[model samples]
Target chain A: MIIVKIGGNILDNPERLQAFLLDFAQMPGPKVLVHGGGKIASALGQKLGITPKMVEGRRITDAETLDLVTMVYGGLVNKNVVAKLQALGCNAIGLTGADANIIPAQKRPVREIDYGFAGDVAGPESINADALEFMLEAGLTPVFAPLTHDTKGSMLNTNADTIASVLATALAHKYKVQLVYSFEKKGVLQDAADDASVIPYITAGKYKLLKETGVVNAGMVPKLDNAFAALQQGVAQVLICEGEALPSINTRQYSGTTLSLN
Target chain B: MIIVKIGGNILDNPERLQAFLLDFAQMPGPKVLVHGGGKIASALGQKLGITPKMVEGRRITDAETLDLVTMVYGGLVNKNVVAKLQALGCNAIGLTGADANIIPAQKRPVREIDYGFAGDVAGPESINADALEFMLEAGLTPVFAPLTHDTKGSMLNTNADTIASVLATALAHKYKVQLVYSFEKKGVLQDAADDASVIPYITAGKYKLLKETGVVNAGMVPKLDNAFAALQQGVAQVLICEGEALPSINTRQYSGTTLSLN
Candidate 1:
């Protein structure tokens, strides 16, 4: 099974999203798509006079922001992607974690920041792999929104990358899961300014050195951490690639940077 | 299998919706809940500077209105209900017609007034009874939003009553299907002003007489038409009741008006 996590930037761009979804639709075998919220939610939030608060690149998900993200991610973006996939002859079903209680989460504990409606998945056990496998076995592709439920009449804003990683790790026991993070860039770059300075392969040691040298900083750190965490948890492989390059990755083509434990 | 369609007014009321959901959760059997969009969409649309157009009680779903309803019905209301049902210990999954391609519809043809983005289900054939039965067999209660897809790419605004009637009629072959419509009123009342004037039972002939005498007029004509249509299409039973009276429906106790084809 292939678990693809598309970045918010791609979703914000219609042309890029269409291209990525086309590649995704043409890919053979069972696959799942997890998408993040884009500017739409923030824009709508602004319209509603709910200015978003961000601390160290992480969103402070207040109750209003949670509702906005739920409407945008779970409703607008998720349904649109499913509809497009259906048009492309892929049997895609849109889902929030609440849909089937597929991924029950707990509200984030208030230590420093009071993330009002943010959630954290306990572990792979939080995922309902059996139900997901049933859908896959029955030839259905699930398109997931970045939202989960507390299983207690509340919805929470969850990270799409975390959702994808946990799902891949959970399904790894049943299927040879390949986790892919698709973003705007071709791959993780060795130099911040040079797009062509794509790192072909990154081992754990090299990743540590890159971070030490300040080569990998900011948002990419958490994303890479998620990727490596998934790899550590029995996921067969992890790839950081551009959205359009997804189809070629399975064919042993060096389309993007591959993560390794070595 | 029992299919319940809850009206918008009841959905708009939290106490009534909670009471209805508790009753629905306690009902002992495989069942489905189909919900209509409340006034939230129109109110939001107004805030967004989009005025809703209605012709003879039917919403004229323009492009903007379709998006608004999709978000309100498919996202906000559906997820809320699912979460509440989960809290009540009912394993409920929310769905739009696009999910699993359960109900494929065609865009409404241009008639006297072009109903933009509105859809009409061809018949029972449009419903994917096998997929629905699969979910039911797996011990999941489906909560349907008032949305369907054109099977090409576009999502359409569909009537919740029609969706419920069609679903019940289609699944009748596999299960003893009972259709219920729960609204603010107790049932079809003989006098619109008196809440106690609810007619306990109405046959086809009596319904015609009641309509001729103007007891049932305006919005209710279509609702009764849908009920009679479902009854004629092999649904075992059809009931028009108050939302809170849902649980007692299966027992010998009559809480609301029952519709009969005789």
Candidate 2:
């Protein structure tokens, strides 16, 4: 099973998203698409007079922000993707973790910096695998928004990357799960400034050296960490590629980084 | 099987909706919920500087309005309902017609009045019965937003009452269906001024006479029409009640006007 995740950058571009979804629909297999909230939420928030609050560059999902994400992520972005996919002959059902109690979570507790209504999933065990398996087995692709429920009557903002990884890890028990993180960039670059300097493959040993040498830093660090964690947790493979590279990835003509434990 | 619909008034009031949902969750058996867009969409549209265009007392669902409703109804209202239902121990899955391709519709054809983005269901046959039955049999209650999709790749605004009716009519082939329209009022009233004037039961014969006498006018006319239409289309029973009366209705105490063909 292919469990692909696309970030906000792709979602912010309509043409890019449509092109990506068309490729996703044509991919021959049972798949799940998890999407991130793009600039739409912040844009809508601005119109509503709700300025986003951030701490150390991380978004603080306050009550208003939670509502904003729920509408933009869960509603506008998710439904639009489902509709487009359906048109492409892929049966896609949009979902948030709260739906069918698919992913139960707890509100991020107060620490040095309170994240407000943010949620953290426990692990693969916390996911409702049966619900997902049912959809996939029924020939339906589940498209998820970046939202989970606290099981206490509140919706919580969740990281789309973590959602994708946990889903892959959880479903690995039943299917050969390939987790792909598709973003704006082609792949993890050896030189961040050069788009053509793509690192095609990275073993755990290589990843460690790259991290130690400060070759991969910033957002890519946490993303690769999540990818490696999924590998350790039973996922068959993990890929990081551009949204446009999905067709090539599906055809085995890999154009991006494939992570593995060596 | 029970198919219940709630309008925007109850949705606009949090406490009232919570109480109503608690009652709904406590009710036994397989059920589905269809919800309408309350003032929230228009309110949000106002914030976004998109003024609503209405003709002949009907809101014109232009592109902006469609986006607005998708965000509010599909996103804000629908997901909130699902999360709250989960908190109440009900396994609720939120959906639009676009999700799982359950409800496919055509964009309203332009004639005298072009109701932009509005969709009309092609009767009971157009509904995806198997998909809904699978969810219901799996013990998941579906909560639908007032939206449908054209198979050609666009989400369209639909009426909540129509959605509820079509679902009831379609599912009647598999299960004995009870269609309910729950709003702020107690039931279809004989006297619009008095809450106690709820007509306990209305057969087709009575409905015709009431219409002739102009006893039930305005919105209730179309509601009763839909109710009767649902009854004609294979639904076993229909009820119009207050949102809080679900438990009572479930228990057969009947605190609303039950409709029948007679």
Candidate 3:
């Protein structure tokens, strides 16, 4: 089984999405797709007078920002992706985290700096794999939007990469699946400024060194943390790679950094 | 503070929603509004191959059923209400329960008799009362569709009346809010078959008796439950009445019955 995380960047191009869907429609096994939508959401926010702000790379979701994002993420972006997938003749089911309690969450407590409406994931209950299997069994690809559950039963914003990693970890342990974080970047850069010098592989030892050296800055920090968390939990392998240009999956010497237990 | 739960029955008529807004706008008090979309949602569902199933009186919301409902609730119905509300100069914010963790919830475990994608209220987090207050403070009406949060971090389907009642319970202690359940019925009938004969009033004690004897049957059961729950939870009063045919907030002799703690 394979789980692919589609970056928000890729969403900008209709051509690329169609390309991705064409490739995806023919891919083997039950594939679960996850997506992000920061770019478009931000644009909508600009129009709505809700200036988008970020805390640690996540949208600082206030009431106004919340409405804007939901409209973008749940409405415009979700439907667009679903339409593309459907056009490619793939039996794809598009859903937000709230559908069927897909992701139970607890409201994040007001911290020193109050972040309004941020949701925390419930660690105790996991995604109902049976329904997922049922969809897969019926030849349907599940395209998930990132929104999660917190104990307060509120819909909270979730990073798609993190959601992908968690789902990968869950599905990997259950069915031995490979999880790929597909983004615009060819791979996780050893230095953020230099995209060419990609880290060929990430290991626990190497990951720690990078973190300790503060090389894993900003957005990459959370993405990697979630990657490592997935590894720690049960995922077999997770890859962070360029989604837009990749012509093949797991092609040796193709591109993208591979993060694994090894 | 009155928590008026309006039915979307009249929402079909733009003039009706506008009239309600005008009537509500003139009312001089702190109040909150909740509403539903039985007609629009069901019609949309039928077109989408999702039959709106009513086991007893509640709509059965399965996966397909829910997808259709979401499209209607979050997209058409929500925006429809918002548009009309906005035109009426109400600073109306249309929301799906998923946004800002508005209404926290617990996913009803799938039973042998499934409620489908339905959810019940959980968590003590009230509406972003301040945000609503800001709007209400500025003379904007907050119109909520019947979606609720499934504490599992996703939006869940909720009956509109229950949503209205829940909001009333949550906000009633702070204001002189009335939990209003507006429906097709003229009022709570002393005799179920006699639509014309609206029960003038019911004491909390009498409500319990009527409820137990099946006078409060089917849809009435949940509505009564929410009504009773609201009273028990400290809501000032509960009004079960005709949402579509009501004369105005100015006149008290509207079609629906009024129930109170007595």
Candidate 4:
């Protein structure tokens, strides 16, 4: 099974997203899609007189923002993807972690900062893998929005990357899962300015050396950390690639950064 | 099997919705919930400067309104209900018609009036009864939003009442289906303003006499018509009642207007 995560960049582009969904529909075997909110929420927020509040470059998921993301991520984006996938002959189901109590999380605790309604997944062990497995075995593709629920009746904002990573790690026990983090770039680039400077492969040792040399861009750091974490937690394969390059991943001729344990 | 549909009156009130959900959760056996968008969409639209357009009291679902309903109905209302139901120990899965291609529809054609993205279900036979039965037998309760999708990849604004009726009529073939249309009122009333004048039972003959005598409210005509349509299409029972009275129906002590073929 493959768990693929796409960020706002791909979601905001119609042609690219349609192209990605076509490739995704064609990919053999069972798969799950996790998507980010993109600019739609923020843009809609501004129109509704709710200016977004960001702290340390991370969004504060206040009551209004939680509703905003739930509408955009859970409703608009998720449904659109499912509809498009259905058009491509894939039986897709849109979901939030709350749907089947699939991915229960704790409301992020307040420390130096209050992230408001943001959620933190306890670990891979917390996921309802059985329900997910049932859907997969039923020939359904699950398209998840980046939202989870607390047991106490609240929908919490969650990170899309974390959702994809956690799902991959949890489902690893049942199937050999390949986790893909797809974005606009072709792969993890050695240089920030050049798209052609793609790193073909990175092991733990190589990543450490790249970090020491300061070759990895700041934006790619968190994604790489998540990739490495998912790999450590037993996910069979991890790839950082362009959205259009999804089909190649299935063919094992992927032109992206493939991460593995060393 | 029971298919209960609740409208905006119950949905807009937090206390009423919670109380109704509690009653609904305690009702034994397989059940499905269908909900309507309340004032949230209109309020949100007002904030975003998208003044709603209506013709003959029916809101025109332009592209913007379609997106608005998708957000409010499918996202805000549906997920909150699912989360709340989950908190109450009901394994609720929130869905729109597009999710599993469970309720496919066509865009309303332009006649004298173009309803824009409005959807009309092609009767009960068009519903995916097998998929719905699968969910019900899996111990999952499906909470649906008043939205359907065209096969060509567009989500259409659907009437919650129609969705509920269609579902009940379709599932009646496999189960002893009881269709319930729940709202703020207790039941069909003898007088428009009297709460105590609840009509306990009505048949096709009784409905015609009530219509001729002007005893039935004009607003309730469509609902009664849908109810009768469902019964004609093979639904075992049809009830129009207060959302709070859900549990009473399970025990055969319902204080609602029960409809039947005479």
| B1-262: candidate 4 lDDT, tens digit per residue | 8999998889889999999999888878999999988899999888887889988777799999888888888888888999999999999999999998899999998887889999989988999887888888889999999999997788999999999999999999999999999967899988777987899999999999998898886888898989998888899999889988888885678898899988
Q: What DockQ does model 1 achieve?
A: 0.76
Question: How well does candidate 2 match the true structure in TM-score terms?
Answer: 0.98
* TM-score for each candidate, following the candidate numbering: 0.97, 0.98, 0.54, 0.98
With candidate 4 superimposed using the best TM-score fit, by how many Å does residue B244's alpha carbon deviate from the native? Answer: 1.3
- After superposing candidate 4 on the true structure, give the runs of residues whose Cα lies further than 4 Å from its correct spot: none
- TM-score leader: 2
Q: DockQ of each candidate's interface versus the true one? A: 0.76, 0.92, 0.03, 0.82
Candidate 1, residues A1-262, lDDT tens digits: the string is: 7999997779999998888888898888999999998888887778778888887666799877877787778887888888889888888989988877899999999887788899899999878888898888888999999999998999899999999999999999999999999878889999879988999899999999999999998879999998888888899989998887887896777678999888
lDDT by residue (B51-168, candidate 1, tens digit) is 8888876669998888788778888888889988988999898889998899889999987878899989999977888889988998889999989999888899999999999999
RMSD of 1: 1.5
Best by DockQ: 2
Q: In what order do the candidates fall by lDDT, top score first?
A: 2, 4, 1, 3
Candidate 3 interface RMSD, angstroms, 1 decimal: 13.8
Clashes of each: 0, 0, 18, 0
lDDT of 3 by residue, A1-262 (tens): 8888887667777777778767776677788888888577675456445677777765577766555555456555564565456545554555555543455555567765557766566542476555456556756677777765442323567767767876776676467777888867788887788888888889988998888898877668878888888888788778888774345655765678888776
Q: What fraction of correct interface contacts does each candidate retain?
A: 0.63, 0.91, 0.01, 0.72
Model 1 per-residue lDDT at B253: 74
- The digit string of per-residue lDDT tens for model 2 on A93-194 reads 999999999999999989898999999999999999999999999999999999999998999999999999999999999999999999678899999899
